[model samples]
Target chain A: MDPDRQSELNALRPDLLRFARLQLRDAGAAEDAVQETLLAALTGSHRFESRSSYKTWLISILRNKIVDTIRSQSRELSASSLADDDAGDDLLDDALFDRRGHWQASARPGRWGDPEASFEQQQFWNVFEACLDRLPAKTARVFMMREFLGLETEEICKETGISSSNCWVVLHRARLGLRTCLETNWFAGAGT
Target chain B: MLSCQRATELMSQEQDRPLSLAERFGLRLHVLICAGCNNYRRQMAVLRAACRRFGSLGGQ
Candidate 1:
C-alpha cells in the first residue's frame, strides 16, 4: 500500500473497531472483523470508489462480514438437533405496553423535584445497554444507527436494506422494548 | 380515525416535539377519552424529565 493509504487505514482502525464492537458485541470478534476488513480494503484498493467516504465503505464491508458470520452460526445451530426456541412472544409482550390508547403524560420539569436526585438515582446507561442487548439483531442495529450513531432514518434504511415501514417498525419495537425493560427493572421500585 | 395503538404511537412521537395539526387532534382526542393512554402519556413525561435531568449530569 502507498504511504498515504497506509496512514489513512491506521487512522480509521480505532473507529472501525468501535463500530465492529457495537455490531458483533464481542471484543475479540470485533478485532478480528476489523483486521479482515482492513485486509480486504487493502487487496481491493483498485475498486475503491471515490463517491462515498472511505469510512462508510469500510464499515459497510465490516457489517456484511458480521452478518455473514451471524448467518453461518445460526445455520450451524439450526442444523443441530436442537430446536430454535421462540423468544418473539416475550419480546412482543414487552413491546405491547398498552393495549388501550391510554399512556401517561410526559412528566413536568418540577415533578421530579431535584434533578440531582434523579441523576443520583442510578447509572441508567447500564440499564439502557442491557435492554439494548436484548433487542433482536436488526431492531438493535436500526436503533443503534439512529439513536447512538445519529444516522438519518433514510440512511439507516438504506444501510440495513429495509423499507421505510420496516425501519419505523424496528425503531418502534426497539423503543418499546427499551421502555418496557426500564419500566420493569429500573423504575419498578420508584412506583412511577 | 386512528386506533388506540396508532394513537399511542403518535403520542410517543409527539413527546419528542410539537405535534402536527392532525397528530395534535388525534392525540388530544385519544387522551381525553382513554384513561390508560393518559396515564401512559404521564409516564412518558416522567421518563423524559428523568432523561433530561440525567443528561446534564456529565458536567456536574
Candidate 2:
C-alpha cells in the first residue's frame, strides 16, 4: 500500500473497530470485521471514488459488511422466536402500570435535574447497555448509530438504506423501548 | 383533541425540536384537558435531558 493510503487506513482503524464492536456486539466479530474492512480497502484501492471522503466511503463498505453478517446470522438463528419473546416481555410489562394504561409520567424538566447526573452514574450506563442489548437487531443498529455514535440522521439513512420515515420510526421504537425498559427495571422503586 | 397515543407520538417528535404549529396546538389543547398528556410532555422533556447528558458517558 502507498504511504498516504496506509496512513489513512491507520487513522480510520480505531473508529472502524468501534463501529464494528457496536454492530457485532462481540469483540471477536469486531476484530474480524476490521480485518475484512482493511483488507478490502487495501485491495480495492483502484476502485476508490473521489466523490466522497475516504472515511465515508470506507464506512459505507463496512456498513454493508455488517448488514451482510447480520442477515446471514439471522438466517441461521430464527429471529421470529427471539422477536416473539421480546414482544411478549414488552406486553407483559405494559400491563403493570395501571388499568388506564398510564405508567410513570414521561420525563419532565427540573425533575431529573442535571443531565450529567445520569451520565456520572455508572449504574445507569450498565442498565443502558443492557437495555440496548435487548433491542431487535435493526432497531439497535439504528439507535446506536444515531444515539451512541452520534451519526447524523442523513448519514444513518444513507448507511442503512432506509428512508427518512423508516429511520425515524426505528429511532422512535428504540427510544420507547428503552424508556419502558429503564422505567420498569431500573427506576421501579424510585418515587415517580 | 388529540388522543393519548397521538399526543405521545407528537411528544416523541417534540424531543428533537419544538412542536410544529399543528402539534403545538394539539398538544396545548390536549394538555389543557388531559392531565395525563401534560405529565407525558414533562416526562419526555426529562427523558431528553437525561439522554443528552447520559448518552455521551457510555460512548466514552
Q: Pick the candidate with the highest TM-score.
A: 2
For candidate 2, write residues A1-192 as lDDT tens digits.
788889888977876786677667878877887888889888884655652467666776776677666545543223333344355445633543334444434322123334355556667666766777787766777676665446677766665566666566566667667766766666553422
TM-score of chain A of each: 0.50, 0.54
- Look at candidate 1 and tell me the lDDT of residue B10: 68
CAPRI tier of model 1: incorrect
**TM-scores for candidates 1 onward, in order:** 0.53, 0.57
lDDT of predicted model 1? 0.57
TM-score of 1: 0.53
Report the C-alpha displacement of residue A47, candidate 2, in angstroms. Answer: 33
Q: Residue-wise lDDT of candidate 1 within A1-192, one digit each (tens)? A: 777778888987876775566656778887888899999999885655552366567766776676555444433322121112225734454345345432323311112233344445445545644666787665666566565444566665555556555556556566666666766656654523
> What DockQ would candidate 2 receive versus the native complex?
0.21
The Cα error of candidate 2 at residue A61, in Å, is 16
Separate DockQ for every predicted complex: 0.16, 0.21
Q: Considering summed lDDT, which 10 consecutive residues are worst modelled in model 1 chain B?
A: B51-60
Q: What is the TM-score of chain B alone in each candidate?
A: 0.76, 0.76
